[model samples]
Target: MLDAVVVGAGPNGLTAAVELARRGHSVAVFEARDTIGGGARTEELTLPGFRHDPCSAVHPLGAGSPAFKAMPLERHGLEWLHPELPMAHPFPDGTAAVLARSVAETAASLGPRDAATYRRLVAPFQDRWDELVGDFMALPSTALPRDPVTLARFGRLALPPATWLMRRFRDDRARALFAGLVAHVIAPLGGVGTSGVGLVFALAAHAGGWPMPRGGSQAIADALAGLLREHGGTVHTGYEVKRLDDLPPARAYVFDTSPSAVARIAGLGGFYAGYRYGAAAFKIDYALDGPVPWTAKEARTAGTVQVGSSSREIAAALDAVSRYDRAPDVPFLITAQPSLVDPGRAPAGKHVFWAYGHVPHGWTGDLTDAVERQLERFAPGFRDLVLARATAGPPELAARNANYVGGDIACGAAAGLQLLLRPRLTRSPYTTPHPAVFLCSSATPPGPGVHGMSGHNAAKEVWRHLRARP
Candidate 1:
């Protein structure tokens, strides 16, 4: 028996456990896989000595996140590495768009019209970013500060479609590049609320400069696990907590698993007639001999690349995924080549690339060659550099991480109805109707990416809840 049991060792679960242990509570974490760091773990997937981050590799959100910043994983043997530049968006015609740390430099690279618009749109938040971000990141139902200016700005930024924002850009390259970045939210680019997703990630890129954890994202998770150990916390890996009754007795339990897992663990107790499902999903990883040769040289600067040609192109791809159809020709892709920045990731001159494209939920399309073909369309000879590849369709993805149920990475849909009334409209997003049982995974607010804020936030609520009882 312990004060708490966290049922996952991902960044979020570790974050929740660490927060509890720091507050002097006994906490235990259980992970299904022998390895911790769900999604953040690094492994030699391709070949000997070639380390690839199986899930998320780049960290704009992780680096800029206040949650991770406070954790100070760097103190525990983790180093956050920033490339000379953040990301490069290259086009088919040999031109590239680069997002740099310096606003002036990024703009200068874009030239006058785009440079001014980019700066103008993003610069106002510089002095007020933290204040503004706090408001935007808050759950839509949460009462915000009574600042009219902040509210107005947040509404304007969040409510608009990403395509609307792109219309402001005069340069075609600039529009395509920014649209690609925003599509990381897994939403249609031209759809409403897409701007909010784009704004947060873009702001983080310039603010934190998009970093990679040295060695791999596992470094961050290892640091959290080490910290928990130092604090008398225990983690049991290779333990899949299928039933709440099976877990060791604890005053409280927080689930870092997916929404569907929560339902399963809760069982047929009148709590889950309203579960969500993903109709389409697929994941593909490639092991390239070198970097993705971009048609435009500047596109190589970015650690993450968005692969839709334009806003319309991005929207259609997303729509296809939503409709559970294999998008024709080019699919929307979120790519991260950490080896471009971290040479230790692969053998000398041999690079490891990681990418996952949107696919029909449960669709078994092997897009390894399709992904390469799209890359080749933008970067000639891209196919020649491929050394090996691996892929996980919906079933395989669900098999790999139960939290990624139906291969829905955000744990659930990130847009529309799900975002507003996530899992249910309880007072605390972490807790459900079930007592001492909590959902701390990415399924909660401020969803997705490698940031462990949801778990940290949920841990706080659960800690208070348990402390207030008995």
Candidate 2:
């Protein structure tokens, strides 16, 4: 009998296992796949030497995670490489808006007209970026935030819809850039609480600058796994836990999976039927013959690039994601060019790029051509350099990881109600009716991101439950 049985070996599950093991509790992790690393996994998806992150590549959440900061991942073989620019949003014209590490520089890039507005909106929180992240990332608390006043100010701006937030900017450059950042929310741009998504990403770029693991996101997962083993946790890959009976006896079971999957795997019944899931994605990874020839100079140096023309267009496209079942024409695309900064990711002089656009939930349309068109719109002749490509639509994503149900990468939507009480409205979202069971996936609070807070947070509760037992 073990102290805990962690079902899944993703970043969340590994973090849970590590946390329990370090506290002198025996732990075991079971992964369905031959390999682990869930959304953080990297592989040769296209051609040999062209490594691609299957789901998540750029890590604003992972890099800015307080939980990851506490770990010795760096010593355990994790190196984060910072780009000159964290992100770039390109327009139809031969220009781009950049999110640099420095707020002044980022504002300046937007031009003097919108510079002050950008500074005013972002700079106020820039100096307190650490405090802001600590407050946002920590488990929900009734007590005031570390900096309540600062949080209140942030909340005023973040609580509004992203479309409303765009009103603050005078020019398309700044507005478009912000819209791109918020599009990660997977919610309609005009929907409530969308600005928070945009604000967090911008704050994160300034807090620590968006950095990717040296080799790939896999490095972060590998390091967490290594740390777990060092703490005496057992990891068994190629072993899927279907029913709770499949797992060894333990005081507690932490499930790093969707609320829907957990109910089936552990016989907990069903999640709230009213649980509203938002959009899914149509993703593509390419093995390029050469660097993407972007007309925008800033995009050449950016690690993650948001490919779209303007805020208005991005908002409309994203709106279709929530209201319709079909993918939008000229969709907003989020792209990451890893080989531009890390040579280990591709063959010499070659590059590996990944991009994805929002689609309706469980969308099965082949969006390969549509996504390629969007890419070529900004970086003309970009298709010429594509030696090979791999794509994952909704069905494909769901098949790979059960958590990414219907290709919804966020696991659960970040809407008005779901954002506050994810996976359902329970006093303890992680805790199930069964005392020994807990949901540690991104489905829990502090929502989506590679940040291990969900796992770390759940483990604290599990640890308490274990300590109470004889």
Candidate 3:
């Protein structure tokens, strides 16, 4: 019998399997799809030479993840490629506020009015990324914080609504860019702990930078899978587990899936009925004849770009999707230009870009026109450069990945108290009622992003349970 059976071969699932195998535990991972990578997969969705990341492109949290840093993924063919700037938020006036590796350069872009405010905001936790991320991502029982005082200080500032934090900036540039950071998880601007969400992104850029895997996001998954195999962990693709009986008997079962899917497959009816799904994303991948023509020069070089004119506009767009259940007239967009730094992503001189805007959950309307229009606002003639395009709505996304129920990419709603306490209202969110079952999806703590900390944390609990059994 295996020591652990992990269902779903997403980053979290694969990470859990690798961790268990490294610890001398017999482990196996079963994936429903023919390949792994889940949201981290890459494909030639448009033109043959134009490779696109259907879900995640630029990874800030991924580059700074404590879980990934602790592993030797680099030795297994994982190389991070950094852009000239981590991220940029462009305005209609052809000026941009950037999140550069240097805090000073980033603060300077926000304008002189809010430069000091931005500096002061990130001062205390500036150089303590290792301790801060380790403490924030791990569960209390699983690991004690390396620096408790720093963690507490960060929590005090991060626990409030992002709206309160934005008030610190006198100008609109800083507020707008920060608002875009908070919106990354599809949460309302005023949601609790939203401040922390934005702050983390900014700090991540300063620390490790928003880097992408050299070839594409698929490298990250392939590296993890390779490391798992080296440690004697096996992965079986094209296998789906509908019930507990579908998997082989194991000492423990760790799930890297949504709460709804877990309850259904594990036969825990209504256990996750109260679990709410947030707004969906309307994503578009483009095969461009050339790079995106940005009005602001900073956006042309940055790996990630935020397309929203002002803080009010960004807030309204998020509100429209999460609260009003409708698409925003001027959808706020988050775009990435991987080909800017990684030329191998496309053919010679050609580029690949992707943009997505938030929409109501289960929304089926075509958002291509709206998304392109938003892009045209910041990057004029954006449509002229597109050679081909592939679009995915909530239905298409759900069809591709079951965990993205209603196209909520973060897996579950990142709102209210649920933002802090997720999957359930328990101290140990990884554990379920069944002693042998555990969940480690993005639906759990430290919420969403490409970071494998969710799986890292879950493995700790699974190994402990396995140790206790014998």
- Local accuracy of candidate 1 as per-residue lDDT tens digits, 6-64: 99999999999998998889999999899999978888877887888877888888876
Ranking by lDDT: 3, 2, 1
Winner on TM-score between 1 and 2 is 2
Give the backbone clash total of model 3. 0
Number of clashing residue pairs in every model?
8, 0, 0
Model 3 alpha-carbon drift over 4 Å, by segment: 139-141
C-alpha lDDT score of every prediction, in listed order: 0.76, 0.87, 0.92
The best candidate in terms of lDDT: 3
Candidate order by TM-score, decreasing, is 3, 2, 1
Candidate 3, residue 387: the lDDT equals 94
Off by over 4 Å in 2: 142-144
lDDT of 3 at 179: 98
**Full-model lDDT, candidate 2:** 0.87
Residue 51 deviation, candidate 1, in Å? 0.5
- lDDT score for residue 52 of model 1: 84
Question: Clashing residue pairs in candidate 3, if any?
Answer: none
Lowest lDDT 10-residue stretch of candidate 1: 137-146
Candidate 3's residue-wise lDDT over 1-470, tens digit each? 98999999999999999999999999999999999999999999998888899899888989778878878999898999999999999999999999999999999999999999999999898999888988988854468789999999999999999999999999999999999999999999999999999999999999999999988999999999999999999999999899999999999999999998889888888988999998999999999999999999999899999999999999999999989999999999999999999999999999999999999999999999989888888888988998999999999999888889999999998989899889878888998888999999999887799899899999888988988996
